[model samples]
Target: MYRGRLAYRPRSETANKIREVNKMKEGIHPNYYQAKVVCNCGNEFVTGSTKKDIHVEVCSKCHSFYTGQQKAAAARGRIDKFNRKYGIQ
Candidate 1:
């Protein structure tokens, strides 16, 4: 019986080389700087972005999907359609 021993695989040398070489040229790309994100719920955080400052309607701290508070806004639309079909105010 012939058996082969397991061998460790080495990382590829050119794995991320393409990305490094294709980086944006200096002064041509948008300026990346520290920007502040202000959420409507008063949650503020600093992150790196091209804009100096950003205002977001929702964030992880207060977003419906993240906080498990999602409401069916589509349900209101359905209700409106039903009312229109039935001529109900």
Candidate 2:
């Protein structure tokens, strides 16, 4: 025991062997469907998901970052203002 709790120990291979095939309960898990995704930029793709149809505002096809259309902001903060004011290199 360490830190008031028992430490983890690996079990032997024979001890970890299972005799029965464990199966998932039917009707309990959500049904996976070939989900249709529609983006606002008119990009469509099919993927597996619990939801049938999905609508998104932005996707990789039209996102500014993915499309390389993102603009870098000329962000000047207090440090920059101070440096410029004092003419610090």
Best by TM-score: 2
User: What's the distance in Å from true for residue 79, model 1?
Assistant: 14
lDDT of 1 by residue, 3-85 (tens): 88788987676867876888878877777999999999999999999998899998999877787645566677889999999
- Pairs clashing in candidate 1? none
TM-score of each: 0.50, 0.56
Clashing residue pairs in candidate 2 (N, C-alpha, C atoms within 3 angstroms): none
Worst 10 residues of 1 by lDDT: 67-76
lDDT of each: 0.86, 0.82
User: Where does candidate 2 stray beyond 4 Å?
Assistant: 1-21, 72-89
**Model 2 TM-score on a 0 to 1 scale:** 0.56
Model 1 error, position 80 (Å): 16
